[model samples]
Every structure is written in structure tokens, then in C-alpha cells.
Target chain A: MKLLEIKNLHASVAGKQILKGINLTINAGEVHAIMGPNGAGKSTLSAVITGHPMYEVSEGEILLNGKDLLSMNPEERAREGVFLSFQYPAEIPGVSMVNFMRTALNEKRKYHNLPQLSATEFLRLMREKKAMLAMGDKFANRAVNEGFSGGEKKKNEIFQMAMLQPVLQILDETDSGLDIDALRIVADGVNKLKSQDNASIVITHYQRLLDYIVPDFVHVLADGKIVETGTKDLALYLEEKGYVAYN
Target chain B: MCEEIVLKANESRDIVIVNEPNVRLRISQEEGSQLRLHIIDWQSADNDVHIEQVASNCVTEIYQVAYLKDNQKVTTHTNVRHLVGGGVSKQVLRFVLSEHAKGDFLGTLYIAKDAQKSCAEQSNRNLLLDDTATMRTRPQLEIYADDVQATHGATTGQLDENALFYMQQRGISRQAAERMLIVAFLSEAIETIRNEEQKEKLLNTIDSIL
Candidate 1:
């Protein structure tokens, strides 16, 4: 099934254009890697898809499962199974991880017309997801990302993804600050969560992450457009010959 | 009328005053006495709280939280005097104003010349939820004793926009996210209430109003 379709999408921030006439399509049961340099609008694509308030969609339309996504609010987009693992996850002090995850999960469930999980059921689900992510028991009690290390923050983001079970997950620069061990753990979690009914968009600058999460198609984004598309070998080739050619 | 109260030597007390309008109180602590005072207001109110540690080995704590909306206004004035050595006093005050609401806080901490080795701290934080809302905070500290430890700080800010957007992206509505953040902001003061039942009731009341 067609999970996501972006046609001629154009976006800007503060009246400055970032994503200029970009097009992409993703089907269920596939992993797509978007590789680019520092200023190639890679993060903007994720922002535009997740409906970040800072980025304004000036033109074009985004569709998820044949429905219009641009008309929805950020929360509505998230409840509709669109999740973006932020490159810099916000740290919210005094808001416990348990309360936050429960609220998000219950909100998603309410949107799907399902019953809200009870406290016990919610705690059980949290434990299950944390175990799946190889996270410790103390993680659920602390404030969301407060006083956490860089690696722990990234791990917590994946733990949230495991709990929310978003259909169209966008990993925006998930490997930016992670060490080799943290990267391996995060990649393993993503691989374990992959299934036939969900799709992922891995946005990264280095080819190191692509080796672990193995994208089905690799695309080079340059100056707000996907200039090249090829198989996984394209990532290796780009690793050798930098983005100098795309510029 | 101002009410007079005293904590006897070696006595301990936890006092919680919620939404009482035009509250005025004068409290004193004796040797080895402990006092925890919580002042929480959800509506427009004016409160005056004065506390003095008159003897050595006394402990005094004060926490105040107020949430006002519409055209409501709240004013709090606190004076904490450490008159003797070996005394400790701490105060935390917070307010959230919305719409055209207004908040004012004047906190004074004083340590007498002979009150050496006494410690006193006061903090006042406020949040203005709307452009038209106003907050005026004045934290005064006067320490005549050279050996005393005294600190005072005041700050006013709005909610964290980044935190709001992060929660929204996790399937929580903007309104819900806002409520969560507001509650979290005020919880710092509310958590200091030693009485769990009273704390729970106050939380429920604030939740319903918010």
C-alpha cells in the first residue's frame, strides 16, 4: 500500500525558501534513505511532513494513505500515524516519562476510536516497550529527557517510537551525536520494529547508519531536490566521493 | 484583620491556605520549632504573610502558587525575618497569569546584625500566558550579619514553545500539552505540601479549573 506521497512540495521558514519543489513516494513495507549534505533541506522535509509550526508550507500537497495531510494540525498528523524522531529532542523537566508516554499513547488510541488503556495496562505496555528497546527500568520514572546523556536521549526517542507505533516514522539525523554503540542499539531497535505494514524514512548525513539499517533505495538530496536515486550501493559510493559532485 | 500565631519551642506545624481572599497572618517560631507554610490561590486574592524565627535551631519554609485568568488579579507580600543565629528560612513563590490577569509579589528577607550563621533563601518565578498579562516581582534581601547566608532571585517568562511542539508531535493536542506544562510548572510548589491528601485535592481543583 502507498503509505506516503509528496508531490511538488514547497516549504519555507521566515520567508526564506528551504524545500523547493520536492517529490517523493513511499510504500508500506519499505525503508527509504534520504542522504544529503548539511544544507540540503533534509531536516526541512521531515519538519514539513510532521507539520512543525516554524516551517510554512507555501505550496504543494502531502498525502498519507490517499488522504490530505497538509490540512491537519501537528497533533492530528501524529495521531494519524506520522511520527518524526527529532534530531534534537526537547527536554521537558517535571513531566515524568510515564505520564508523557501514557498521554501520547492514549491520545493516539482515542483518535483510532479505541478504548483508553487503564493505568495497569499502560504501565505493562510501557515496560514491554522499554524492554524491547533494551532500556532500563529507571527510565520510566524520570522526567522526559531531563538530565539524560546524549545517547540516553536518543534511546528514549526510539523507546517512544516503540510505544506509539507510528506507521510512517521519520528518523531525522538520528545518528548525529550517537557513538558507535548507541548507533548500533538504535539501529537494532529500528530493525526490530520494522514490519510489512509500516515504512520508515531515514534521514542522515553519514553512510555509517545506512550500513546497519540497510535502505531499499538511497536518494541524494541537494539544494532542496533529490538529484540522484539508486540502490544501497549509492550510499557506499557517496561515502567514498563526498557531496562535492552534487554541489 | 491580621491573625497572630506562634509555634512553641520544639513544635512543628504544616499550614496550608487555599484561595482565601484578603489573608493576613503573623507567625513566629521558637527554638527548635519547624514551620511549613503553603499558600495556593486559583482566583483573585491578596495575601500578606509575615514570619519570624525568634530563636536558634528554627526551620521555616514557605511555598506559594497562584493561577489566575481573565481579569483576575492576585497579590502576595511575604516578609521573612531571621532574628537569631542557627535559623533557616526558605520561600518559593510562583504565579501564572492569563488574558488580562495581573500578579504582584513583594518578598523581603532580613537577617539581624546579631543573627550570625543564619541561612535564608527566597525565589519568585512568574509566567505570563498572554501578551496583555502583567507581573511585577520584587525580591528584597537585607543581611546585616556577615556570617549569614542569604540569596534572592526573581524571574518571569512564558511557556516553552519547543516543549509544546514536541508534545504535539507525540499525538497530544496543543491544549492538552499546554495544560500539562502549566501543571508541571506549578507542581514544583505544590509538591512541597507535606500533606498528601491536601496536595491531591489542590491538584484536582486546579485540574478542573484549567
Candidate 2:
């Protein structure tokens, strides 16, 4: 079954057109990789999906399981299982990781009308997720992304994903700036969390990540539109050829 | 409203004032005395805090946090005088205003002659949630002793939009995210409470208000 369907998506930022009419569909358990060079509106697509206020949806319809997504606010979209693993996760100076994740988790739960998790249960869940990311106990006590290294920041994003367990996760350049070891660990965590009921869109510029989290479909996004679509090998072809041909 | 208090030699004092209407105190510190104070205001409160290190080896620390909303106005004025050598004073003050509320803070630090080796520091930060809310801050330092060290800074501005958007994208509602950021912004003063239970209560109170 289709989990997300974007119909004629047209979005803009600050009165400048970026995404000119795009369409895509993702089924359950499928991984879609969006590969493109700089200024191809790669991040813009994710921002519009998650309802970033900075972007204006001039025209489009986004459906999550046939429910209208564009009508919902950012938090509402997140509650409905649309997550964006930001390329640059925000540094919250004084908000602790535990507090941040717990608040977000509880807020999602509350939206679904579930009872809040007890403090002990919540802590245990945090510990489990942190362990999955190969993070330490001391991490939960520190401020969110305050002093984290690049790899640690990306790992923290995955840790948050593990905690939230969003169904439609959009990882925008999650592999960027990651060392080989950190990339493997992040990919491993992503692989472990994959399930038939969830789907992900891996947005990146390099095909190196596709070797780890192999995408079922590879789409080339250039000039705010998907120029081409192919199988996993298309990622290889793009890596060999680069985005120059599409541009 | 105006009161005079003194910390005797080697004396240590801790004070916390919350939701108080008015505060005016003239504090005197003797040799080796110490004073730590926390002030939190929510309503219309006028405060004047003055401290003088009359003897050597005196220490004074002040932390103030005020969260005001809906037309509430608060003004706090602080003056610290290092009259003797070997004195240390530090102050941190923060105010968050929303919905047409107004806040003002004036801090003055003075290191008199012969007060060599005295050190004083003061910082004030304010957050105006919306364009309607307003804040005024002043940090004044006068040092006559060439050997003393003194620093003071004050700033008032809106909440960080990047930080707010970052939280919203993480599935936290903008309002909740703003509350979290505000609480975090005020944590410098909140973390100073020594009593755990009181600290938790204050934190909870701040959260509930947000």
C-alpha cells in the first residue's frame, strides 16, 4: 500500500520558485533515494514534506495513507509519522537530550491519546535508543547537540529517529561529514530499525551511502524536479557520471 | 520597602524571593562574609538591591529571573560597591516578556580606590517574545582601583528563530518548543538553587507557566 503520495508538488521560499511541480509515490517498506547536486531543491523537498514554515506550498497535495498532509502543521505532520533527519540538526543550548526527546515522545503520544510514559520507562527507552546509536550514558545528560561533533550530531539524529520511530523518515544528507566508521554505525542503526510497515527517503549527493542502505528506487532530482528514476544501479551510474549530465 | 541588612564577618547567607511585590534592601558585608540571592518575579514588582563590601574578603552572588506576561511590568535596579580589597561580586539577571508586558533592569558596579584585587562581574539578558513585549536594560561599571577587574554586559532581543524552527521540525509544537527554549534560556539562574526540592518546584512552576 502507498504510504506517501506527492501530487504535483510546487513550493517556494521567500517568493522565489524552487520546486516547480513534482510528483512521487512511496509504498510501505520501500526505500527511495533522491540524488542530485547542489541547488537541486533536495532539502526543499524534505522541508515541504515536514511543513517547514519557511517554505510556501504554492501548489501540491501530499497524502499520508490518503490523509491530507499539507493541511497539517509541522508538529501535526510529525505526529502523523513524517520525520526529517536534518542535515544540520539544531543546537539547543540548554535543553537536555533526555528532556527534548521525552517531551517530543510524550507530545506524540498525547496526540495519539496514549498515556504518557513513566519517568523510569522513559529513561529506559532513552538508554535503549542511545545504546542503539552507540552513544554513552553521559549523552542523555548533556544539552541537545550543544557540543556534539559532526558524526555525533548525525548519530544523535538517528538516535532521535529510533526513539520516535516515524514511519516516513526523510534523511537529508545523513551521511554527509560522517567518517567511515560513523557512517557504518548510522547505516547499521537505520538497517536495524527498518520494518515492512515503515518507509524512508534517503536524500544524498553521493552513492557511497546507497551501498549500505540500498534504496529500492533511485530518483535524480535536478532543477526542482525528478529528472530520472531507475533501480539501485542508477545510483552507481550517477556516481560514475556525476549530476552534470542531468543538469 | 527599603531595608538595610548586613552580613557579618565570615557569615554566609542565602536568600530567595518569588512573586514578591516590592524589594528594596541596603546590604552591607563585613570581612569574609558571603551572600547568595535568587529573585523571581511574575507580577508588578519594583526592586532596588544595593550591596556594599565594607571589609576585605567579602563575596556576593546574585541571580534573578523574571517571566512576565500580559501587561505585567517589573523593574529591578542593582548596585554593588566594593569598598575594600579582596572582594568578589557576581550577578546574572534574565527576563522574559510576552503579550505587552514590560521589564527593565539597571545594574551598577563600583570598585572604589584602595579596593585593590577586587573583582566584579554583571550580566543581564532579556527575551521579548513578540514585538509588543518590551525590555530595557543597563549595565554600568565604575572602577577606580587600577588593580581591580570588572565586567558588565546587557542585551535584550527576541527569541532565536533558528532554535524555534529547529524544535518545531523535531515534532515539538512551536509553543512547547518556545517554552523549552525559554526555560533553557533562564536555566543559568535556575540551576543556582541549592535545594533540590525547591529547585524542582521552581522548575515545574516555570514550565507550568510557560
User: How does model 2 score on DockQ?
Assistant: 0.77
The per-prediction CA RMSD against the true structure, in angstroms, equals 1.2, 1.6
Q: What ranges in model 1 sit over 4 Å off?
A: none
**C-alpha lDDT (0 to 100) for residue A111 of candidate 2:** 94
As a TM-score, model 1 comes out at 0.98
Candidate 1 residues B74-176, lDDT tens each?
9999999989999999899989999899999999888999999998888888888889899999888888999988888899999999999999999999999
Candidate 2 per-residue C-alpha lDDT over B100-195 given as tens digits, one digit per residue, 9 for 90 to 100: 999988898889989999988898999998889989888888888999888888888888877787677667999889888999999889898888
Error of 1 at A183 (Å): 1.2
Q: Please, what are the lDDT tens digits per residue for candidate 1 over residues A1-247?
A: 8999999999999998998899899999999999988899999999999998899998999999998999999999999999899899999988999999989999999999999999999988888888877899998899999999989999999999999998999999999899999999999999998999899999998999998999999999999989999989999999999999988
Candidate 2, TM-score vs. the true structure? 0.96
Strongest candidate by lDDT: 1
Question: Interface RMSD (C-alpha) of each candidate?
Answer: 0.5, 1.0
Report the TM-score measured on chain A for model 1: 0.98
